[model samples]
Target: MSDSASVDIAGLAPAVKAALLEVLIHGELPRAEIARRLNLSRASLTRITRTLVDAGLLAEGGTRLMAQTGRPSEMLILQPQARHVLGIKLTGDVLYATVTDLSATAVASRELRLPSPDPADVVAEIAGVAREFSAEYPDIVAVGIAIAGRVRQDRAGAVVEVSAFLDWTDVPLGAMVTEATGLPCSVENDVRALTVTEHWFGAGTGLDDMALITVGVGIGCGLVVNGRLVEGAHARAGQLSHLIVDDAGPYCDLGHRGCATSMLVNSAIVGAYRVAGVDYEGVVAAARAGDAVARAIFADAGRALGVLVASVANLTDPQKIVLTGDGIAVVELAGDAMRAEIARRLDTEAVDVDIDVRLWDFSEWARAGAGLAIRDMLS
Candidate 1:
């Protein structure tokens, strides 16, 4: 339609635009550099930036330029404190929350034990956490909440199906959180929100396509393609957890046998450990001790994971594959076999793909949540 609309920041209403500018207000950049980075013309960037400056979302500064540069160019910086947002991560056992400024830096954080896993109670607790954070950061504009269980759009962002994991079905969670926190709120699938964070600023930042596999209590994969996180029409795209590696390995919660998760997930390994009469923690210690049986269990999971990684690399053709999660504690024992299996499963030259195995701590997850809030502001 018009020039500003053509800037490619879709879904960015004026409020969102002001929020985005506020995120950049602390860091000054030249007009031409900003245009180049954001893929907008200098004229358009200048106009919108001036508008943001006038709105107090950004500040303009200048200095003398070299003779070839004619004069020192004025610079634009984001006034990050102009606004802020809150992020909440709810899981089966823990409630991790953060208050972040427009730049996505953590201002405050809280990790409290969950009172109960009940959906309403959990949502209420989440809402309470948001309220608490908002009271501390009075300028907070919106909130981004992430849930570990399945969250989907029943009718487009209405959070119709929160899935059977936490028994959250057709719950008006977004509305509830908004009403409780007095801020616009949006709930996200935890892994997908984490993926969005990674795709934009972490390991996958510049790659047009990549994937993150979280191997923990559940096997999760998040895929990005063509510079956008893949959100399938059904919002169930990267369910690589149930890729059916064995077709008969073990019964999975998905009612499938030998799924990737069933055969290779942490619980699955615990099952394997039990078969050998060892506890899960004992198994990790034994693997560290190079116990053959413990090592084999880790190897089995790694091999299964390797095949799945090969599948993702082949199917998505992503340039990078990042492996992270709580499962990585034993990954060292399984990594070699997994690598071998990945090589074996590749049909072609494997695209010369690079794989990064990482261990995600609470801070990274919190940062991902903050990044989600930042992304919400940008959009």
Candidate 2:
């Protein structure tokens, strides 16, 4: 495999980059189809593909029969192994890491305990992991860090504006990691990073509009509108946690009663069950085993989730809604109530949206970071 660092993706012309991205996301496609999708003339498409193929960023595979015509055309595919990136997901107490190729497919992963919440210490640990991965995967070209907080990116690089879990604010995390590891680096909100991965290579592929809702210790959302990820002015475009669902619901830390966070989060589910020493998974198991109280709690949470989904659909009308994270099992346990609530809120006959439930692990989040790195390189 060629070293991605030597390719200089940012130096590619806009049309060539778009052509590469087109093949990267949609897999192999005939040159005619690529030209049709990108609205490029045959000559322009040929030049773009030639440039990418010369760079080893794309390759021509076996021929495919074109539907529009009876002739066969060469299939263009991404050289996925041409580039590798290190992705890291940071939580309060642990770090998840992965090495992914150009397509954001995780090839290897590891987990490490955070020795401290201190920013300096965290940076050191991330550098250590970057070094280890670089030694094993010499093609790794960049690093992407995903955290649960607000992030701001400018020419100066990315900064963690606020992270409750890490208790950090205005930290130049991207530059710090770059300086520490001698590699290009970028930072993004964990949920938003995951949305990028989904949009390009996972569940939301080929969709111009979508929403990803994550249920766990908290309720987080990521939105894509008009083929672009909505990063609000403050980088909090999809902040749906505090949206009120039930006036009589529980209270979040900000004292919002009956909010999405208060009703649908893992803690809320466990608290609603009023069970001592039981975790969210335990409660889910009980519900599955025919425990009435547990089932009722899940039902309530599901209803809240339905309300949340309805609100997103009502506002953005996304083509699909992706439900994921560690707490996604609640969807299976209380699917009936959730679907009913959605039906009650939306015009079922007029609106058709696909809801995809994905049981993702921490390593998936790490791969999201790699996706961000790939995006940054291209941009």
Candidate 3:
């Protein structure tokens, strides 16, 4: 991250290349503005922009008026179709995969119903998907996979450990991937990968610090700080789903009670409604219908979630908080209660960051994995 060292032509530079790349990928930045933000020089910036443009890496555009002088600025935009990356999200029963060119634009995607939970079987099937995707696109050179557990990392931030939710532990996922797909592979935690994708190109883009909370059959949290995803002590720091919010909360196999997932997940909400003797069309419908039991269930879930969000904001003071997942439907069920509790405990002044809670496509999760691979290749 220092300037004196030489930058690898293959890897993105710390400042100049990174700044330009961000503008291109995210779109619409002026030359003067890019120079000011990245502490760059206009002449040097033009040279870089020209090179990127000539290489079909960035698209250069017109100028915007600034003050009295209509200072001309080179606008940088991504050549999304220049390169390609492939990603897959592995679940117990199925896998969703996509191939994205350099700009993080999805070119082709696949959804495969898997055979067994055996890691080897899953890996082979995934390799076949990659092979097919690559054969179609021909520009793909990197592959990534997103799993749902801790990825062991060393002190230097090298990822060395992973145990996907399928009960596979200490697996050499990245290595196996490269060997099978014959491309550089980067394995990431599904949530963290999703967070990275969001931070750079999705909802969380242009924000320095943020959190993405996901709700589904399971609950997951991904944290980003100072433009880097935090992979604490073996990449398991953001495990807020297991945090106990209820002393008498329901049982979790992970040995915690009253956790966010235990009380707020899809299964939990459905189970709560079932216990109350109501059939369901999702938690959102149940709550909208004024089912007191459903309302109570979601409210409880919201309260617990509020506590979790408060903990993150209180601890990190990130610029924004993004709530997303396969189960925003449930959050919609008790939106008022969840927002109320979040407002109650959230430090409005100390944590001045805005909260952006929105629903996203499920495939975005898999694409995030591809984004990580693209990030790795670009770096």
Candidate 4:
């Protein structure tokens, strides 16, 4: 293959590369249309697309007839399979993975249940998975791992600041994974990784401003402002769990009474009923079966969530707010109350804001990991 076939796209200017990928993402477009949308001159567009085309990332497709002039302009196409990326989601006991082409299409996936959360043991398992995958898909260039909690990352490696789910802190996760797998690795907060996928491929796509709300074991939010994910000064910009919703509500070990986390998190709900080992799914079923107490619990939780979401809407004014995670069904069960609370709490001018609810699984979170790799490629 020619050198251009393996060009280092990371060297391109941000605007030039972004414009090219924008066209690639939106699909084959005529030169004029691409330039007009990107606010670039024909000459500038030609220069940028030329570099991409030469790098085997973009190609010229058949001409498109212009509506007004009846003239033909060649269209540009993205070579999605030019490269591949791997994504993994690391839970305390399970490791879920997926391989995706440049377009973020999953070609294969895997799941591994871990007997231990030891960093070395988990890294070894991941290396084994990467090796098995490499035999069939050699183009895989990078891997992304998503875990719950605070993560600090740089080109050299990543450190898991704290992970309550895994009971890990200050772990050099990225370096360990990279040394074992012989591939570049990125570590990101699970919810933030999901937001990355949503921004590029899911409900949040094409929007410059949006927020993703996840309600599972905990409540988390991810913000995208001006087409970029906001990590904040402390890398905790979207920590919505602590947002106080009711001063007299239940309290967690953190001692925050009536906070969204205390009122809406899985543990809070489970603790409320004092059902021995009852999972969130059971709570959903009970509420759906006309259990008044269960319904009331969900109603309160929903109201808490609604207040948290409305606070985000009022402050950020995002174009869309996406809700997902294990607690989504509970939110649905509490639909009327949730909606009413949201409508009542939101500023009158923001009442028309769009709220989207989606269901996501571990594989989807893994896909978000793949999205991190794709992000590196695009940036």
Candidate 5:
């Protein structure tokens, strides 16, 4: 185990830990700024920061000149490389992994295609990856695994209540991985894990309220409210992909007609073309070439997504909404229609909210797992 893995963070006072985290999140800040942001008096801030500096968790960096006086104040900065963590995203047939520093910056990554989704098989594969990363970066303290499912976790450990894609249920995923790799493991819902990454280090940074909507083989959402990821009672909070957008649209596997899953997912779009006797590639090519039929199909999907986005905005009133996933290309193709529908559906209060569109790959999700590891270590 690394020194960080054995460090006694519990020895620090809670207020001191909070102060250290504030600096970790916002980067180097003057002592006065830290005190103000943390709502602490100068004496309190000094005590907390000094303890963190003594613990080697924080470093006093370059001084900043005060505007009111000619005096300078030293800035408190977090030591990003103080510890490293591993994050793994387990899909149906692939495990994407990344090694990140305390700041959640990926310094190394790898992918392994699973031969099967059996619990033991996946566990062995995860152990292999952990060993590889451990050999290269002995500083890695713990591992985070993100799976697409209903994850249940408590003081005992984490279990996958259900993994719809992998057809898993009631599996002790955290225990399995930990035993296999000889390291602590944290398992989380993939979307929720991804949300944690965003809340801590990605686009959702500095915003207390934001939503991430992913479009792909399945529609997924992650929500952060009041500066915390909302993992509901059963840890299945943001399941909006099945929200019905059109009553007459295609039926989802869950049996919802015209739900976001039925209209916006890649499988749904490709299935629509198959039903219409058109090749999938031909449909995308035609859509790009302005074919009326292909364009209409994408436009309809976009409109459904627009309704979904607007509904989320009205309900949560988040500061920002991120649109991303493997199927986001469809949204870009039909951007005009989607924007129009969003404008029409949004309440006056939500009309001006920022909706950022980003294209993402599996590596980002892996990084989310790493972010969760960091959070687990700190917490």
Candidate 6:
């Protein structure tokens, strides 16, 4: 196998890149199937696959019998381990890191406590981690950083327009990381990164439209429409946290009363419990053990979340709505109320959107960074 760095992925022909992506996302497939999926002639598909194979990005694997033809056909598979990327998810206090292959499969992971949230300190930490991983995994080609922020990608690099959690504004994070580590770096909003991971490999795979709503320290939403991730004019398309849920509920930092964030976020749930020093998990456990007060708080939060989900469905009409976050247990504890609210608000009777609850894992967020790196490589 050759080094993946020898292949200029971004310089490849568009059709060849598309063919490679199809194989990467769908796994091994017969030439006829790949040609059909990509709308390529058999000759064109052969040429594309040949280029990828020569570049060590693809391989011809074991044969599969074609049911229609009663003939054995070789399958083209992605060379996932040919190269690797470092995926880092940065929060205020911790940095979750993982190394993933071309297919965005996590092979190794680690966590580091942030000594400080200063941009310089964070960049240094990221550089140190990237160097360590590159030394261990010599094929590491790029680094991707995911943070809760508004990121803008331009000719220069990815810029963090704002990251309220880290008090970062107008930070040139991508360029800094790349310069620090001697590798290409991509920066993305953590929620959008997760959405990309879902669209490419997780629950939303193969779907043209889907929504992900995360309820945790903060409420966030990511949307995919018409097979594309939606980044609005200002890169703030999915800011549904402040969407009004009730006029009489609690207030968020933005002073919005009964907004989705105010009603459904971890802090809000904990605050509503009104018990000294009790965290969100404690409240969830209490609710599970049949504590009325805890149950009521979760039920209210669940209903608010349902309203948000219904609103997303009514507006975007996604095929699925993924509800996930560290605080997602609220959905299980107050599922009945949430479903009732969703049933009441959805305008369409013929179309029932699938709501999937995924238990949160910080490693998944790191994998999202890997997904972004994969996308950057392809683009």
Candidate RMSDs in Å, in order, are 5.4, 1.8, 4.8, 2.4, 2.5, 1.8
Taking the tens digit of each residue's C-alpha lDDT, what string does model 1 give over 52-132?
765556677675363556756666676666666777776667878887766667788889888887767876787777667
User: How well does candidate 5 score on lDDT at residue 23?
Assistant: 78
User: How do the residues 1-379 of candidate 4 rate in per-residue lDDT, one tens digit apiece?
Assistant: 3576457655678767887678646767788788777898878888988888877788889898978668888888888877778899988899999998877788999998986988888888889889998888877788988899899976679899998878898999999988898787888998888898888878887899999999888888999999999999999898788889988898877888888888788888878867887777787788889988889999998898889788999999999999998778766788778878889999987756698989766588888899887776677
lDDT by residue (1-379, candidate 6, tens digit) is: 2554577776789898898898888878888888888899988988999999988889999899999789888899988988899999998889999999988999999999999999899999998888888777988888888899899997889999999889999999999998899888999999999999888888998889999999888888999999999999989888888889889988898888889888888888889899998998899889999999999999999899989999999999999999998989888988888988898899966288799999888788899999998888887
**Segments of candidate 4 deviating more than 4 angstroms:** 1-5, 8-16, 37-44, 66-71
lDDT of 5 by residue, 1-379 (tens): 5444456553557788778778778888788888777799988888888778766678989999978557798888898877788999998899999999988999999998998999999999989988888787877778999988888885667999999878999999899888888778999988888888887888887899999988877888898889888878866788888888899998998888888888888877787766566655567778898878778889989998888888888889999998887778777789888888889988876557688888777798899899998787667
Worst 10 residues of 2 by lDDT: 1-10
Better of 1 and 3 by TM-score: 3
- In model 1, residue pairs whose N, Cα or C atoms come closer than 3 Å (at least 3 residues apart or on different chains), thus clashing, are 24-78, 25-77, 25-78, 25-79, 26-78, 64-72, 65-71, 65-72
Give a tens-digit lDDT track for model 2, residues 201-307.
89999999999999988888999999999998867798888989889988887889989888788888888888789988899889999999999888988999998
* Deviation of model 2 at 23, angstroms: 0.3
Please list the residue runs of candidate 1 whose C-alpha ends up more than 4 Å from where it truly belongs after superposition: 1-29, 36-43, 54-82, 117-120, 154-157, 247-255, 275-279, 363-366
TM-scores of the models, in the order given: 0.83, 0.95, 0.86, 0.91, 0.91, 0.95
- Angstrom error of the Cα, residue 77, model 3: value is 2.3
Query: Relative to the true structure, how large is the alpha-carbon lDDT of every model?
Result: 0.72, 0.89, 0.73, 0.84, 0.84, 0.89
User: Candidate 1 has what TM-score?
Assistant: 0.83
Between candidates 5 and 6, the TM-score winner: 6
Q: Which segments of candidate 6 are over 4 A away from where they belong?
A: 1-5, 65-72
Instruction: By lDDT, rank the candidates, best first.
Output: 6, 2, 4, 5, 3, 1
Q: Model 3 compared with the native: what TM-score?
A: 0.86
lDDT of predicted model 3: 0.73
Report clashes for each candidate as comma-separated counts: 8, 0, 1, 0, 0, 0
